[model samples]
Target: MLTFSFLLVIFLLTILLAVFDMMILDFSIWEALINLYFPEVATGRSFVYTGVFFGFVICIVGDFRLYKKKKLKKNHAERDGSP
Candidate 1:
């Protein structure tokens, strides 16, 4: 759960940074995202975008695991009849 929370925070921070870049740097978020995932040529921006994407994937996986764990616990509690 801690890892999930930490990754979620990082993912959110990266999104905030991307928004800042879009507003202040006047760059297209769509372009950065497309190039990052489907790169024809390597650029420094691609690296940052990659980190953002990787963080997003990690957060999603972590959240899924946490959800499954919580669901399993709920099922067990219900089965045991311990309200």
Candidate 2:
């Protein structure tokens, strides 16, 4: 259940970033973000890509942090012989 929640968060963040880029930069709503990495792409596209990438990366890091915390709690509980 926690994992599903985290996945939903990441997905929502990705969509929000994409929509922000579209509204603020006039970028194509359906444009493939991967294309922004190419040197041939416009500078605006590069910026949009960077923003989206960072947004998703932050979500992934958060998910990892949550997983670590959950594991640590589980281990502590086991040591205490509870549940």
lDDT leader: 1
Measured by C-alpha RMSD in angstroms, how accurate is candidate 2?
6.5
Clashing pairs in 2: none
lDDT of 1 by residue, 1-83 (tens): 65567767877876776677678767698765554346687657767878867877787787889899999999998999964
Model 1 TM-score (2 dp): 0.50
lDDT value for model 2: 0.70
Q: 23-54 in candidate 2: lDDT tens per residue?
A: 77777856624333343647577677688678
Worst 10 residues of 1 by lDDT: 30-39
Estimate the TM-score of every prediction: 0.50, 0.50
Sliding window of 10 residues with minimal summed lDDT for model 2: 32-41
